[model samples]
Target: MMRHPFVLFALGTFAVFLLLHLAGGRQYVGVLSGTVVGGAGGAGLGLLYALAWFGAVLAAPVLLLAGLLDGALARASRARP
Candidate 1:
């Protein structure tokens, strides 16, 4: 399971997002809403946070599904004697 590339990618994406979120990335995300929590310097941080967030939201699910399909195909192939 862990050997699957898609799964690894999804997990990695989620982990990065989790780390950023834990480190107060949420505050920076307000930049998107015109809040500007930390001024100009924060804009970059907010962008990073936003990218990670979007990746986790958009790519993660597709990666997970690809991983699942890959795993299932591998299993099916192995079962064919």
Candidate 2:
């Protein structure tokens, strides 16, 4: 929902993460920079790894926070009337 922008962003990032993994980016994910060198495929894999890492580390937290905020807002609204 537009009201919960973070929830949407997190969900979108998570979907991208899943897509990266499904595209055979698992081995490439969580790897250090310069670990794999050479070719266009290598470059693509590196990008995928970066995206997946962000999705896991960044989006997950945002999603949790969004849920917490949504719940708190719900409670506050309910208490008002």
- Give the best candidate by lDDT: 1
User: Could you tell me every candidate's TM-score relative to the true structure?
Assistant: 0.86, 0.64
lDDT of 1 at 32: 89
Name the regions of candidate 1 deviating beyond 4 angstroms: none
**Clashing pairs in model 2?**
none
For 1-81, candidate 1 gives per-residue lDDT tens digits of: 357989999999999999988888778877888888888878778878899999999999999999989899999999999
For candidate 1, the lDDT comes to 0.88
Question: What local distance difference test score does each model get?
Answer: 0.88, 0.71
lDDT of 1 at 5: 89
What TM-score number comes out for model 2?
Answer: 0.64
